[model samples]
Target: MTYDFQDRVFLITGAASGIGRATALKLSSLGASLALCDINSTSLVTTTSLCTGSHFTHSFDIASSSECTHFIKDTISLYGKIDGIFNCAGINPTSIPLEDTTDEYWDMMVNTNLKGTYNITRAAIPFLKSGSSFVNVSSICGLHPFPTFAIYCATKYAITGFSKSMALELGPKGIRVNVLAPGFIDTPTNSGVIAGEEGVKSLEAKVSLGRLGSAEECADVVAFLFSDGARYMNGSVVEVNGGTAES
Candidate 1:
């Protein structure tokens, strides 16, 4: 599991917790320096604390276009180059039905999940050298419908399509782009919502593996994708779900 990315730089958003936090630590273990971004300053600090000091952190709103510009400028200026970029900052649209959904909620989901990713990747391309990787965090919801999560799923679907198109456009530059779609991962924030006794049983029943996923497990796949091991893998959607969704 050793990645030969020593001294390489990776920029990751949503690094404060969950999958983002796990990936940050995992990449650090593989010897990559990092520029971490998140809105949660307190939690973002904690995430960087788990890594080597060869990391810089920014507490900027991913939903803000101006802030995204400034964040990218600072990272490139500070690190000189970026070898990988992981777009993970996103909001889960509220579970209210479409009729009850507000303009604010729809805008929030689109801004954070869709526009935010566009901002960073678009800005970082000039800073990335050839053979760099771009990994966007998509979800199973993007592929399969979940009741009451329309906008959330839509954003993810857009990311999936967008990643494929970008992969082709950037391939000539030797920059690779891929998406990771994780299903039913058990993180602290989602523990209560998806991990109670009844909830757990229902989720387990839905998956052939009969269990939930862990953030650390998903991180492993992403680490490989970001490394030379996944060199031929571009314009791909790697599903980490436990046989819960079928192609």
Candidate 2:
């Protein structure tokens, strides 16, 4: 379907790289105005340069409630309104067994991944109008298991649950909430996964498509979720894991 985002304004966290950057470019090409944010200011600027028409960029900690409020206010001040939001800012630190995980490490992951998503969503909710959609970035691990990635999996699972609940609460208010669960996407964020040729093959083998997916590929789905085409879709979890999700 042909997607057009003319005059629409979207707020995207984690726009510095990977699927977030790809989605910004995709939406911009479709004629949307963007408010992009990330903790990495340097890379966020690069993403802005790659996009087309009207856009703004911010570097902030999504984990901070005040920072999220500030960014949302700035977006409203510039665009006057928000049409949608993409909650993609997150982190995947070194994976270790649950027993080996420390309290500090747990707080870091929970704050950035789960609480960060919460911060932005809460801040932006009041600004969203009817038909606004929320496309939250989860992971295959959110739906499945990764032995040593307890904290990562926990945060992702929380996102899925949170998004679904938001959909139920916001649907009557004309807002749609959905989840994007990607698996082994070939982005700089996941460079370590496909580090060696052998490693690539091994990882790819787990996917029915027999390859790692691309950030751009995942971006396509994000665009659809935000488009008029998906007006009826709400509280749905869409997986872009190349068939890795259980049947």
| Per-model lDDT | 0.87, 0.89
lDDT per residue (tens digit) for residues 1-247 in model 1: 7776687989999999899999999999888889999999999999998985569999988878788888888988988888899998887545678888889888988988999999998888777789899999898887788888889889999999999999999999999999999887777655324447786777677788978899999899999899888999999999998889543
Candidate 2 on 84-154: residue-level lDDT in tens?
Answer: 89999888657588899899999988998899999999998998888888999898889987788888989
Best by lDDT: 2
Q: How accurate is candidate 2 locally (lDDT)?
A: 0.89
Q: Which ten residues in a row have the lowest lDDT in candidate 2?
A: 188-197
Question: Number of clashing pairs, model 2?
Answer: 0
* TM-score on alpha carbons, each prediction: 0.95, 0.96
RMSD of each: 1.7, 1.5
In angstroms, the error of model 1 at 123 is 1.0
